[model samples]
Target chain A: MNLAFRDIRHNLGRFVLTCFGLSLLLGVVLSMIGIYRGLVEDALTLARSPQADIWVVESDSRGPFAESSRIPGDTREAIARLYGVSAAGAITYQSVETKYGAKKLRLYVVGYELDRLGGPDKIVAGRSIVRSHYEMVADRRSDLSLGDRVPLGRNMFTVVGLTENRVASSGDPVVYLSLRDSQELQFELAPPAARREMARDEGVPGINTVNTVIARVSPNVEPDLVAKAARQWKHLAAMTQMEQEIILTRSVVERARKQIGLFTAILLTVSTVIIALIIYTMTMDKLREIATLKLIGAPDHTIIGLIIQQALAMGTIGFAFGALFISSVKDYFPRRVILQPDDGLALAVAVLLVCILASALGVRLALKVDPGEALKG
Target chain B: MSLNGSHTLVEARGISKYFGEGDARVDALREVSLKVYPGQVVGLLGPSGSGKTTLLNVFGCIVEPNTGWMSLDGEVVYDEGWLRSDLRRLRLEKIGFIFQFHNLLPFLNCVDNVAIVLSLAGFSTTQAKQRSVELLEYLEVEHRKDAFPAQLSGGEAQRVAIARALANRPRIILADEPTAALDSARAGIVMDLLRKVAIDQNAAILAVTHDEKIYDRFDRIFHLRDGYLDIEQERGVTEMTQD
Candidate 1:
């Protein structure tokens, strides 16, 4: 008769409701994991987008993402002249908050030289920046349209192009500008600060510094070798493309990863505890029936089968619902949420194992039931 | 009636059962002995705490007797301790039990309640179900075979319970206060059904009850008091039968 299925059928409403409740808890857990993955991906988006073979920054600085690094913009010329260096581009990065309509928009501003390697690869709409001073390429997430003028510091820049999925480690949309404009916007002092410096007889700081100088090696040359050569310069530090990504993941987004992992572990534990409590309660509700079953000479496995099967059913159904829920709504989340099939499969296996461990309590209680209880009035 | 040639289905010799220990010790049964033959419906009558239920449990192999041997269908199953390692299997194959309440599994319909016993004894599902339907029809509750226990009337539930007990075609049936919850008319009907089942299946039936109204339905009645079967009642009954 498949007593476990029969019992669930008999109480279909309550059983479904229980599975639904469990699914909601599981859904939150899944979304948290996806969010963590998104954070890491977002953190590496700009780093990967540049596609440079080597990165040269100021000595002793992890930048241009994890920490601040400032080297003269002309460092690109020296790097471009180096052996095995095919091309080099000086770039500056700074976070800017400005008014977009009535809402505040945060953007990671990138300044690169014209005809350089550090630029948006995929322009989904409009055209790439044509003019050097005021034209910009903005990510679609910035909600800026072509020809929309956005004021930054002392100048208003027009959005000439649009990109997608381009964001900084902090989840801020990215915007691209000419190196001259970015350096002036990021390093140049405001008019008031410049005036104060002039009154104090100190010369205005040069607006010719950049955060990083990215270089691409020749086809036959090793990028690590080029980076090794660049590292010998006392005033410059260099890393291969792989090392930059490692630093961004390990240093920039490490805490967020650990936090999400802790949350996932705690949620799974809570799920185990909740499932155990629910299975225990369900077993308690059927003690008399179990005693009756035992009195009828039912094998111990039959009773144990009933409890464990119910727990497994709950876990399977709950995980299915949670996976469907998270998959359907991931795009609508504020940050990009990536749900990989491998992650879902891993969680499904986890849920199944957790259910088995959870049902132990119920099985123990069922085994302890006295068959003689059926004889009592 | 004197047993002359009929096969004994259930027999217990000098069974004793106790509970607790030392100053807190109490004897629930003392040197109880009896025999039941096929086609006989015997009744054990006693007041509350008189150990009639305890004796029934001992006969059913649910409880171990402190000192005694018990046999079922000519096999010596208990000698102070159980002779079989799998008491559950022995009970499943040899004994059937009915309780004070119907004790029908609430989740299972009437036919399934009856069929589960046969299933546990390794009958194929189809075979178990076929036997269940036949038993339910025999008990005249086949009309409610699809109804869950909660959906059936009290008498209907008890009939289903009886169908379950008879599913395995066991040689001996042990019932504890089987009619205690029924109205007088319904109790009489249940008792009549039990008697009919015993005669039809040629199974020995032992019922523990306090209800005096169904005493006429029993072929022989034993009185228990303070953990002992009253020997005078047996003698008086024998003398009355001779007269």
Candidate 2:
């Protein structure tokens, strides 16, 4: 064992170079897994923040991304009156492309009742929205800071606060505004179309409606009862917090989840094959030495152990490099690459296993080598 | 003659080894028998294709013969079947081998390479290392202990190989053309070291070589031809016939 370690130390340059190559591949695998985890985390962050017990939307729809769900603006008022409903608020959601400097940025605009119940839980910078309209709390990733003005539709809103990681299902950074703003952004028609519709409808202004009503239930009251009462109403669907998150994840981001899963699987397969080939080649290169060891009474187990130890060393070094490399450069990527501790740990274990399995090919070759070959001409 | 009650370190009876089968079969050794007693140097001399290596392999317990009764260190080790399943342990504990080419692991320093056999035999790392250093000092290569095998000269490497072979303190040392790669001077030095190790350690040494120039140094010489062995007494020694 001492000899084996000393041998590796003597050839440290080649060993480290091989480890670096392995680490790059391992880093890609780790990044893929992290990206998938990031997507899931980003989807749930907004939903979890509201602290709402139940969500009310249109019948037979998954919100707030997969399908349209518009409820009467007065639905919150009605739900507030219901038994066991402690608080209810109208919320609207929409994705829009807007200009920031010379670049176009995609934003998930979340409309909430500023004072009622829905808003960013904590502001990291500046102050929370003080005005009712044309003010927003932007997630830090949106590149918006306090006092910065961003154009939305025909109006421009000043960013009042900066939050972190508040992204929508599609992983776009979120911007929070009063419910009226989000509703207008989603439902407000063009001025010409609005005039044409009003002219056709005898010039009466339309009432406001919203995509969904989120409610908090009292601890003493059963949540299912409130949800049942809301579902009894026409054009309404009520779900508990758990159900809403599931609906969004299973319906809105189902395709992305599957795509990420497929990518992870393919990357893992490629990594395994590449590691196996590298170990096999290394073993083949040392065939003569291995034969001599065998001839000199070195046991098969010793030979196998040498190969396995080398494989494990390669994997450990590669994983360390990959982890460091990805985290150091993750911020520069367009999409969020979340490198978490658990993800790193899992990848380390996986890479180690891959290396062990990979070196089996080398072990087989070493085992089949005839000791007699050492004596041959 | 039976070596049942003698000081023989290795004894073989009617050893036969064949390769392949049917018409393609080649008999590498046929009905070969030899005895090597402790504290003596025995040389097996033969030309190419004369079964010298085949006999060495059988004596080294690396290849099982088709028919043989072999004993090592006064204990039966083979009788048409291997008596020990752990050939590696047998090789490490009972016999030492020095090859023509100094097959030291390239990545290891001279001392570590010498200590490898002891380490494989379950010695502590520190103990094996210390023993290797002691042996190198004995062989007069201690100054080059930290040098890798590649950095050592031919004579130093060969001397290191002898030290490695003696690491386990085996009762028998087998040298298969150990000096084949060296010049006359280096070969003489290696042979002298082998003889000193045999006498100082009280171990039997069996060396097979084509070099006849060093024959007088061996205590006994066996001439092998077509897998048959003939004992040749030295000119000054009296030949003892079977009673």
Candidate 3:
């Protein structure tokens, strides 16, 4: 018979309460990890959506995600004229909040040329931007349905398609539209500003510009080399697909990753301390019993085994409880918290190691207990 | 049960034990010596701090004496104040201890508490449990074998304790004030059970106690006073009160 299990069964109330408390701690750790992973996914959503091999943007800027980089709309034509460029298009991104019925919705609007690779990677509902002028493909997270009309600037556009996990790094739902329409919506001055400009005899020279010009190299050409060739133009900075992904991932979501990571570390440390204190208290409670076992010819290994087994059982049970609880409520979080099986497995292994280390405190205390005390008691 | 009542199971000669050193030294045992034969129960009686517990501990291999020659079952297990064999294994396989408290593992039922010694002695679970249940049955605690220590009354717990002590059929049993925690009636009952275990299992039983009611139960009685031991030649009997 397992002494550890029997002891736990004998004290079921305390054991359950301990496990419940531990589960809450584990749940917080799991949530932080999921949030970090989700943040990365969200950051990569915009970057990964465009399948172009290289990005051409204003010089000294990282990219559209981490830093604002606007290039002339004619840069697409220049990039297309390059020797290894197979496809090139102009795209711009800007956040806009517009009145939809009684609700105000914030949306990340992206302008992509029809022939470019900057469309939503997966269309879950309706169709892609089929009509150039007033059609939009929106992330399902925007809560927009197909055929729903949304007012932007001076025109009303209809949602033509829906996609999932296509939100920006800040969790703003993305809306896709034609490059020319988006440029007009984002770059065009307000009527009052335009009136002031005309009165001042100043021309709106940059109204036709786009934030970025993306290009795809031919099959046999290297994107890095093509990107280097694009960088030769002093007016623009260039990034290969890998560099763009790295910048977006490292700079766009770096703070969220660190915050979540720090929170996770603090939680795990708290868990380890709690487990150590609990195991120590439990072992202290069994001092007499352990001493009796020792006095009665029970080996030291058996006593240590009992403590270690109980610690491991509590950790595993807590992990299971936390995993189930977090999985059930992940969708309720305002920010996406994606709990993948791999992260759960990794956390479980880490918790188990912490348990083993935590149990050492109890085992050491139990080992030092004098068996002769049992003779007196 | 191949015990020949004439053969001595345990012998300790001139065992001297002292605590501390020099000016602060105090002798706990002063050349104490005793021999126990199979199929008999010996009682060690003393007031508190009379060195009775110290001698019992020495004989049980829980502590080594400053100077002593000790043998169990005709083999010298300790000499010159040092243990000559594995004391833990010797305690597990050759000697049994019953404490002031029953000391049954509270989490384990009566049968498991009894079976653990056998299990630790390399007996398979099935064999250990079977032997343990049979021993409890012989000790008249079979009905309470499934009950945890807390659920059993004082007499029942003591019976289970005895069952645990005899599970391995050890040659020697060392009991320290085993009846002190019980009422006069329960103490008599526990003493009777210990005597029965001694005779039936062909084992030598050594018990330390102060209960006047159960004085007549032991086959031999020794008294301790101020770190000195003496065999009581004659004693008076008294009627044990029952509740």
Candidate 4:
């Protein structure tokens, strides 16, 4: 055993080179897994941080993404009158392509009541929005620093604060604005269209409404009861936080999840096949030496150990490189690539298992070698 | 021809080995029996395609004979059947083999290559290394202990192989054409070292060779023709000519 390690160390260059190649493969696999996890995390961060218990949206619609839900803005006031409702806030959501410098950025613009219920949970670099309109708190991923003016619609808004990883279900970075500003963005028509439509409606513009009303129940109250009570209203359907998340996952992002899952499976299979081939090649290179060792009375287990140790070493080296490579370049990716310690640890263990399994080819070859071959001239 | 004081270290009784079966069957060794004793250096002389190597393989416990009983140190190791499944371990502990080419692992230095067998036999690394250094010094290659096999000359490499074979202090040393690759002078030097190690360590040695010059130096010579052993006794131990 000691001799085996020493032999590898003595040939450090070859071993390290082999390990480096394995590492690159491992790194790509790790990055893919991280990206998949990051997508799910980024989708739910905005929803989770607010700590709302229930969401009221249009019936038969996936909230904020799959379809539009416009309810009377006064729904918050009505929901707050319910027995278990402690607080309620109306929110508006829309995705828009806006310009920042030379780039056209796609942002999920969220309109919320700043004083009562909605905003970034924490500001990473700047202050939260203080005004009712034209002030924005951008997710850091949007690359907007404080005081940077972004053109949205026909108006320009100054970025007041920067938050981290707050993205919508589509992985678009979020920009938070006052409820009134977002409502106008969501429902306001062009001036010419609005004027013509109002002329037909006797000079009265359409009533103001919101996509959904998010509600928080009292600490002692059951969120399910509050959601059921809100659902009694015919024009609205209320969903608890859990139900809303499920709907978002199953309805809005299900396709993306499946795609990421398929990618993960393909990468795993590729990794396994590559490792197996590498081990098999290395074993073949040492076939004569293995037979010689057997003839000289080195046990079969020794030969097996040598091959297994080499495989494990390759896996360890590959994983280290992969983790470092992915983490160093994660930010450059279009979507968030979250590299967590637990994820890396799991990948390391998984790759190790793959290596062990991959080395079966080598082990079988070594075991089948004929000691008599060593005596042949 | 029987040297009484040098009790038998290896005994092969009516050993026969065949390959394939039916029409394709080939008899590699046919009813060959030989004995090598302690304090003796026996050489097996044969041409190519002869059964010298086949007989050596049987004696080394590397190949099972079709029919025979074989003993090492008066213990039956084969009796028309295998007595042990761990043949590799048996070879490691009881038999030492030296080939024509010095088959040292290239990745390891001379000391490490020599020490590997001891290490495999469960000796501590320090003990194995210490024993290896001692053997290298005995073989006069201690100065090149740190050099890899590739860094050594052909003669130095062969010496290192000899040192490695003696590392485990086995009961038998089997040298398969150990000097076939060397010149006359280098071959004489290697043969002298083999004889010295066998006498000093009190271990039996069987060397297979086609070289005719060193035949008189061996204590006994066994010639294999077609598949049978023909024993010849040399007059006495004589110092090898240094040239």
Considering every candidate listed, which one attains the maximal TM-score? 1
Instruction: State the lDDT of candidate 4 residue by residue for A158-236, as single tens digits.
Output: 9999998899878899999988888778777888888898889857455478888888898999999998998899888
Runs in model 4 deviating more than 4 A are A198-207, B230-243
Predicted complex 1: CAPRI docking category = medium
Clashing pairs in 1: none
Better of 2 and 4 by TM-score: 4
Worst 10 residues of 1 chain A by lDDT: A331-340
Q: How well does each candidate superpose onto the true structure, as a TM-score? A: 0.96, 0.92, 0.93, 0.94
Lowest summed lDDT across 10 adjacent residues in model 3 chain A is found at A113-122
- Please, what are the lDDT tens digits per residue for candidate 3 over residues B135-216? 9889888999889999998888888988888888888999988998899888888888887887787788888888888878
TM-score of chain A of 4: 0.95
How much is A198 displaced in model 2, in angstroms? 5.0
- Cα lDDT tens digits for candidate 3, A99-174: 9999999999999888576777789899888778988998888889999999999999999899987889999999
The better candidate by DockQ, 1 or 2, is 1
Per-residue lDDT over B1-243 for candidate 4, one digit per residue giving the tens place of the 0 to 100 score: 245655578888889998899999888888887777777788888777678888889888877899988888667889999897777888898888898787777778999888889988999989989999999999999999999988999999999999989989988999888888899899999999998998898888888888887786678777677776654555465222111
The model with the greatest DockQ is 1
For model 3, the superposed segments whose C-alpha errors exceed 4 Å read: A98-104, A154-156, B1-5, B21-24, B234-243
Residue B70 local lDDT, model 4: 88
Instruction: List, residue by residue over A258-341, the lDDT tens digit for candidate 1.
Output: 999999999999999999999999999999999998888988999999999999999999999988988899888888888888
Question: For residues B8-110, could you state the per-residue lDDT of candidate 2 as single tens digits?
Answer: 6888888899999999998888888767777778888987877888888888777899998989998899999999898777888888888878778888888
Please tell me which model should have the higher lDDT, number 1 or number 3: 1
After superposing candidate 2, which stretches have Cα over 4 Å from the reference? A198-207, B1-6, B212-243
C-alpha RMSD (angstroms) for model 3: 4.0
Candidates 3 and 4: which is better by TM-score?
4
